[model samples]
Target: MKTKIGLFLVVALFLNSCSTSKTVGKVPLYEVLVVNNDGGANIKFYEILTEANEIMLLLGDETLKKKVKKEDAQKSSFIILNAGPTKETFNRATVQKVLEKEDAIEVYIKDMQKNVEADLANENVFYPYSIIKINSKKQIVIK
Candidate 1:
């Protein structure tokens, strides 16, 4: 009986070792990339939080810094909603209605292909929903 019990324990341990589990996280799951295209090429990443009026900037793979940038947070959420899976299934009118409630204004920018292309390859460094371009005058431009 002792030998049988030992064998069972060993088998259990082996089985447990073979079985793997991954704890999939939900919060802090969304990512946005901020690329400085005003000829500076200063690239950055942030974890967007729409409800709390704050964002956590991802400095590196393991470091995150939180800041309260309400305007940026709101705009980022708006762009994501307009550019994400919801837009793929819903009509423009429906999406507009949802966005209207948040007072999310549409940002427009033109002739940014040369600037945007400069940092296109850097996008691989972070997963961004959409990148906003800033001009020399520090104006937000959406390309």
Candidate 2:
């Protein structure tokens, strides 16, 4: 009886320790660039970069375009959403929610026209995209 009880206790502890941890919340939007226009956002592609070489290849700017602070170890996990030129305003692309699932990281976004009033007098084509920093480095699946 004593051995059986001890065995059960050990098994229970092991199971508890193996529980999965997830990050679920409204993640902040990492806005680095600002483009002035009244337009819409049509996501062309989403890229996940954790290495310096890859970051430079895609997010490189000044030397001549998209860039991420690649030196910091803490900001290793980055998901960038790139949008194509839009005729209407995709004014505000927001990251609504982030779910860290077992297989992948799920991201919910709002890429529609913003309700807030904007000066349309100087209306021009706008390009918009959203980016977020995730706790995990899992593959992102946008929803």
Candidate 3:
């Protein structure tokens, strides 16, 4: 019985240690870039990350929610930026370069648009694109 109890305690401790939640914290600098495809209609592509290495999709934006509702953005499929292709990669160098030339957020969005254009072009599909930038740090929230 003592051995069984010890085993149970060990398993419980192991499980407890394994179970964890993501700790959300403020990054020194973060940016959010959005790309709206005219073809998708209601969806907007977003790429968000911080200098601290935290990156993910943003599904809950009150302002964007309102805009989506007002602008009928629900019909569209909003995609998070994929970090695969060399040109599509969102890294510190690209971010810094954009920040140096123009607004960080603007540069991010422009780069996103350019990436999308290049992607579509590689596929030989032509379409219109629009890029929007939210430069404020408040634009990126950790959750």
Candidate 4:
């Protein structure tokens, strides 16, 4: 009886450890490059927030891409974002072209709170048996 009890306890402990060791889909704090394609000469960087709201700086472009070699891109600043599945690479000329575009580009992680806020704000409300439209509009309009 004593030996059997000891074996059971050992098995329970092992199972507990295994369960705790499993990897959950949690966001990690890491940096990513945000190449702005806008015509603005100045380069702007922002930190990405993980699912847990952890922020990390951008570490510049240092990945393997077919066209853009590692040496071609310049390291500016750091920003935080969730680590993506595939690595992204960019060349100096491509970065320049991206910077030259009309829209400003940023690479950072978004938190769950922001996602919730956006979802709550973007919904449409309807009244029962009536044409009542609940239009949730923003106060400020940027041109």
Instruction: Please report the candidate that would top TM-score against the real structure.
Output: 2
For model 3, state the Cα shift of residue 107 in Å. 3.3
- Best first by TM-score, ranked: 2, 1, 3, 4
**What is candidate 3's lDDT per residue for 39-69, written digit by digit as tens?**
3222223444432222212235533443332
Q: TM-score each candidate.
A: 0.28, 0.47, 0.24, 0.22
Q: How many backbone clashes does candidate 4 have?
A: 11
For candidate 4, the TM-score is: 0.22
**Model 2 over residues 1-143: C-alpha lDDT tens digits?**
99999999999999999999886986343333333343234435566766656655544545214334544324446666655555555445557777777888778876664333333453554555554556555666889
TM-score of 3: 0.24
Every candidate's lDDT: 0.30, 0.56, 0.35, 0.25
Task: Please give the range of 10 consecutive residues that has the lowest summed lDDT in model 2.
Answer: 31-40
Clashing pairs in model 2? Answer: 39-88, 39-89, 39-90, 40-88, 40-89, 40-90, 41-90, 59-66, 59-67, 61-65
- Model 3 clash tally, residue pairs: 2
Model 4 misplacement above 4 A: 20-143
Better of 2 and 3 by TM-score: 2
RMSD values for the candidates in order, in angstroms, are: 18.1, 10.8, 12.8, 21.1
lDDT of 3 at 41: 23
Off by over 4 Å in 2: 1-43, 56-75, 87-90, 113-123
Q: Count of backbone clashes for each model?
A: 0, 10, 2, 11
